[model samples]
Target: MSSIQDLETWEPLLRLVRAAHAEQLAAPGGRFTGQISLGSWTLPAPQPRSAPGRALQVVDMQDQFTAVERVQAALRADGASGVSYVVETGPDGRPLLHVITAGPAVEHGVRSPFVGALLLVEGAVPEPWRRLPEEFPGAAPAPSADPALLERTLRERLPDAIGATAEEIAAAEARLGVTLPDELKALYRVTRARWQDWSGDYAAQERVSTAVGCELFPLDGLYIADARSRPCPWQYAAKDAVVTAPDAAVQGLVGSPGWIAFGDNGGGDRLALDLTPGPGGHAGQVIMIDHERSIGAALRADSLTDMVVNHRHEWRSDVAWNRPPVVVQVSTHSPVGIAAAARPELEVLRIGPTGAPVSLASVAGLPRLRTLTASPGTLADPLEIAGLTDLEYLSLGAEEWRLLLSAGAVPRSLSAVAIDVPGDQHPLPVLDLANELLALWDRPLITRTVLEGDLGTDGKAGGTR
Candidate 1:
């Protein structure tokens, strides 16, 4: 047997678990579950608490640290990334250990026992990230826009302010690969707004903020807020939709190449000039990209001049368009059923646990449907998903995936996949199912190391090898 599979290699870690969960393991059918990797762990060991006037020292949890280090060293030697383990009492009143290593389908550093989302097709991004803003020929500068007035107002507000040179402004524009707007250039020409120029003066910073109506970024700090700038994981990103109302002033998009970020709202939100405006918007309009949101920007003002001179900082919410939702969830809590969510605009569909099994017949031919996630035992027939020819991402339970794999009906259009493993299910079957999926795509399979050990009846490790 390999060193990793040797009983002695896992004794220290087992001892640590037994020490912490003795009473729980002593109960009938009681089990302890966790995951561990070389860099991190999620064991159920007791955490060291800090006392008054003193911080916790390494000695407070030396046993835990040492035991975890031993397991990590063995994993490194065995060339494994992580392992999920389950501990339960044997019939003879000793602890039995089952260590399951991760496969390529499982993402690294994920503490969850089940395989989440796995990217099968390389370099495929979520649908929203691939979407771009629609062109509006009627878009033009706002009537309130006056570069001369904006520059004049700043000069009067900060007469002694240091401004950037024409050369400095040109360098910034070149670096960002986009021409700076006239109003933004004028603002920078009056004051560069660099920290070094302010010389650590809080009053000077306040004066600049008062003059510009917001915290201003230096010319060199300007960047195009493109879709790539705001990145989200595939699991969450797949559920988002890009929708813009007909009368919206700003386009609803993940991010835009035309958005030039220039300042902040003092609360981490960004202020940018939108050159590519929506149908009812003006060119060079100011928009606030809220830090808390992943998609869309709120219109701050019609133009930069209007924002600074008129103090037009009122935030208008995105217009509510009466269009069908692009993402839909079918559960007991949802108002709409699968039939209602079967529109051509549907991109993501999720089926949660319901009273009866749901069928995919309603949403079978959705042209734009790219993602589908279903809970275990929710689908009436797992084979019904074969009709979803356009699916780019699919997540199903182990049994559902097995049915698909058995019939050779796994969607070829899939770019990624995930298997939802139940807590009560053993890892051996889940790992096998994961490998089968990986094999279908010619991806690397998951490797396992079985380490069986005996923790004596007295809660002490007895096995040496």
Candidate 2:
């Protein structure tokens, strides 16, 4: 038997693996006879492979997850304390692949190993994967006591607060035509407007954004995004004012004529107050609602004062839009380029050049990220990578879109998504990914939007939202 260390002996297995994968990708018109050979392996024809060929060469490049397992297996099998290996697929089809590490893997202690390459295929990228973090059901958490030292944190951001005067609150209410919640009124007394930014702890800072200002619709800086807009939609309101999209969806989610906007999370979700007291429910309670549609709502607090005093954290708009990314798309495969992609809040990662598909997985157990995105050509199943429970938004090419649609491997937890459907292919099915989402997840279906192309007049193209 050839030892695993003997690169020459492992040639046949690599050949079989390569040929098997390429064959799976074969199609009649799009049929490709080319094969990728890395290291000592050769397919039907053994052409020269360039430096550091790819270890994972399955149609879905992510299948090379086994490559990681093998490296760690080598590390532990040989009793080595640590192991490192590099696998790169050059521009040419033939790659120079090698696996010299040993062990099931332990940690990323002080050294860096060769991470996998994430392929980027061209096609339609899905929508729910690209939304902002604040788009979630509730940011931070349901209302609780504000984090300690919030006053200090606010002081750091806002200075020269305009004390709330009885006349000021009264006049504001008269103009707006709604009774201010005690908590909201107190917040006005404390600060008129403040930027939202939080980096302390994820759980504690969940919905601290509810306290910040919205330039689009500033109700004393604490603007409610999905709440009742101007021209108040109340049963009784000023005759001259124009009514807007009520936070309650005008009897869609929860029937409440009395509603008020408090804060906009930036994306679409908003912090609001249900002013109408139901038979059992109390008035002036804080709640969360989706702005795009009447999905549902979550009660945040008994009152705005409760949210500001207890259930809040410090968050302001650092992103021009609302959500921070769990996954990031890059344009290069160079190590230096990938290093630049790291940030404290980022979870998932990808590298995709225009024509060249990017499929990478060089590191594992990423600290705090919940989702990862990649090219469908490389990793058909993202779960193969350890610790990846969810995926960030995807920007895909056409061939990649066909692959994912056929396989249907997208995660179920994703609630907010964005996609760019191409208008090239004819006789394409209008993609109702929303319907698919509604079938999969129990919550109000995910928020889906198309950025670039639309499902046009003539027969729409593939991946049309």
Candidate 3:
């Protein structure tokens, strides 16, 4: 058997738990549960208190560290991420230890310790990441855009600033595979913004920031902030919807190919020139891509010339106007029912615990519906999910998944799936269900080894159970 399945491998950790929680273990119907990984842990063991004269040292929890280190070593040897553990009093008044490791489909560091598997088919991404912006036929450069005026302003602001050569600008265009916007080119022509040009001078960089109204990136640093550039995990990315307001200046998208990132807002947010504008937007409008957000850019200025001349770096408004009810959650707390949420614009629907199980018939034919997440026992009939033909992502409880699997009614159009394991349910059954889902897409299955042992009546390590 692998070390992960060997009783000896877990004895040290069990002994530490028994020692720390002796009183609790001695109590009637006592139990303890926690999870541990290479980098982090959540255990019932007591933490070390700082000494009078000094802060707490690693030696204070030396025994705890050593016990966890052994388990981590076994995990590394077995190519596993982490393990969850359960300890309960046995008939003989000794502690029983159950170590559980999740399958490959489940993400590590999840607190629940059993299941929340994300089954992704090869090369498949969340729908929002795959969504491109809607085309705007009448989009054009802003009226305030003036390349010559921008260059002249920069020269007037920084007389000693060195500019890029025409050859350098052409090379950048060729490298990026897109023509640089005229305003961007003009800004760069005044100062290349290379650090080496300033000779390690902090004041020079500050002066450039003051003149440019933001921290500028060098010509080589400029890149298209496409959807691929700002990556979010499938669970989060699936919930987002791309919704552009008809009268807005920026198109709501994960990222745009036309968004050429030229600088930052001193904070981490990016400043980009938007080439793909919304219906009411100008092609060369300046937009700020927030570092905290995964989708959409905020309009910072109508034009780069406006930004530089008028110093319009402050956000006009971060909120998206004319946003439709694209995401709907149906639950006991939700204001809208499933029938009320069945709008054509609805892209995501989440079914939480409700007074009664809901029917999918209400939201079956939503054109833009791509994501659906239903909590355990929230569905009146799991088979009704087959009607959601456009579902790209679906997350449901294990029992609900089993109903669909037994009836051969799993959605073929799904790009990804998730099995939500609730409470302290055993990992073995959850792993089986997760493997079955993975097999549908020919993906790898989650595998685990079980180790069983006992803590003796005296609160010391005992032989295998």
Q: List the residue pairs that clash in candidate 1.
A: 103-446
What are the Cα lDDT values of the candidates? 0.81, 0.37, 0.81
Best by TM-score: 3
Better of 2 and 3 by TM-score: 3
Model 3 ranges with Cα > 4 A deviation: 1-18, 21-44, 52-54, 57-109, 114-117, 317-324, 452-465
- For residue 171, model 2's alpha carbon misses the true position, in angstroms, by 9.3
- Global local distance difference test of model 2: 0.37
Q: How high a TM-score does candidate 2 get?
A: 0.28
Per-prediction TM-score: 0.83, 0.28, 0.84
Q: On residues 263-304, what C-alpha lDDT tens digit does candidate 1 reach at each position?
A: 999999999999999888999999999888888899999999
Query: In candidate 3, residue 171 scores what lDDT?
Result: 95
What TM-score should be assigned to candidate 3? 0.84
lDDT of 3 by residue, 162-212 (tens): 899999999999999999988999998999999999999989998889998
Cα lDDT tens digits, model 2, 32-77, are 1211122221122232343476643344433333433443454455
